[model samples]
Target: MEAVTKYSETELVLLLKQRQQSAFSYLYDNYSGALHAVILNIILDTELASDVLQDVFVKIWRQINSYDDTKGRLYTWMLNIARNASIDTIRSKNFQNNKQNRELTENVYESAGSTQLMTDKIGLRKLVHQLKEEHKVLIELSYFQGFTQDEISKMLNLPLGTVKTRLRTALIQLR
Candidate 1:
């Protein structure tokens, strides 16, 4: 295969559409870091994040034909895939069980930092402190922990509307 550095996004995407392996190799070389960071922010575990990143790339290859240029750029579509996959990872039963096991042994000061992986992963953890108690929990459940509104409501023992309101409020605060 030739040097893919010279390939433009449009050209690379075209090659991907044609199922060229070289283009995918180029894609992984170029975009894997950014995609992995996206996964790490949600997953907060390097090994799990790596696993999710692999799944994200596989899904991308399979679903490349479904991408719509009219909707957004290729990277945006890929980023969305990474984000969704990371959220799915956190929401998995295995993840929850593993998380609980870690929490049991985790020290108070270290717990937040470990679970967050660091504010460096995403700035949300730092910004989360600025939100109200209710709003902050809602955001944590909905965004970081990948809970649906209904699931969040059930988890928090609140109505769906209240959960949605808190999340919206929390997001507005973050902005």
Candidate 2:
């Protein structure tokens, strides 16, 4: 068996920035489990989360130069990248369509009595509906339907700042 190689965070960052393959391998071996768990928390689906995890690593590799050690720890930076990538994947149209298709297939297989269970699964929407009409619309468009703030702004003919402020206020209310 080959001996395991260990690197300090600084060493790992340096080697990674230098594009050393072994450093990347070591980084993956040490960090992927934690990163995968973070992504899985957001994405929920293992296959999709795995894909996001791969994309996260690719982003880490390519964006290593942009990483500033003075700003934060290496793992924290990677964690943010993994989290953002997972959120981006879930917010993507393809992921939403695939999710809806999967839900439809599952519903077809389920008995009629389970329809209520599916409806209950939409509890988040139910909660959002309790908000004022404007806030509700923003939540539905941005969270449920995965529309970006800019898209919501364009669709509602509102300024981007207003969209962001409303969304932030809606989230604060939800919390």
Candidate 3:
């Protein structure tokens, strides 16, 4: 194998679509650090960041064909995957237990942002944070963690009727 020179993100993505090892190597070498930074900034744990980085790359490799240049750049797509994975990992039961063990409880409601976690996310993080505790929790479970209403009800130990009522009330307040 010869040392490869520079290639634009588009060109590398094109090669990646063809499943070229060199292209994969180039993409990882060039963008891994940026993506890691994005994940680390959101998750703020070195070990977790590394794990999510690996997951992000695996997703990118598997879903490369889904990339569409007309929509956006390759890095943009990869960034979205990294952000979602980081948020997902943080929401996992493992993360919750780990937080309890470490005495460092994380609030899923508090991890919103404009760059790494949720850039331009409904333009409502700051506003949502100002909401009542019940509202904040409902929004976090439903929007941030991607949970359905029933799941949120079970997680919160609340009745399904209560969850629906709170979510509806929260939306009205937000509006």
RMSD of each: 4.8, 8.1, 7.8
Taking all chains together, each candidate's TM-score versus the true structure is: 0.71, 0.55, 0.56
Candidate 1's TM-score reads 0.71
Residue-level lDDT of model 2, residues 87-106, one tens digit each, is 67765734466567445333
Candidate 1 vs 2: which has more lDDT:
1
Misplaced by over 4 Å in model 2 are: 1-3, 94-175
How displaced is residue 11 in candidate 1, in Å? 3.7
Question: Alpha-carbon error at 52 in model 1, in Å?
Answer: 1.6
Residue pairs clashing in model 2 are none
Best by TM-score: 1
- What is the TM-score ranking, best to worst? 1, 3, 2
The lowest-lDDT stretch of 10 consecutive residues in candidate 2 is 104-113
After superposition, the stretches of candidate 3 with alpha carbons farther than 4 Å from their true spots are: 1-4, 94-175
Candidate 1 clashes between residue pairs 3 or more apart in a chain or in different chains: none
Query: Per-residue alpha-carbon lDDT of model 3 for 57-136, expressed as tens digits?
Result: 99999999998989988888888898789878866744656656222223443353223344333244545666788887
Per-candidate clashes, comma-separated: 0, 0, 1
Model 1, range 1-175, lDDT digits (tens) per residue?
A: 3462668878988999999998899999888988987677667778989999999999999999999888999999998899889877665744556567345223222444456436543655678756776776777666666657997787668998888877888898888
Please, what is the whole-model Cα lDDT of each candidate in the order they appear? 0.76, 0.74, 0.74
lDDT of 3 at 62: 96
Q: Can you list the residue pairs that collide in candidate 3? A: 114-119
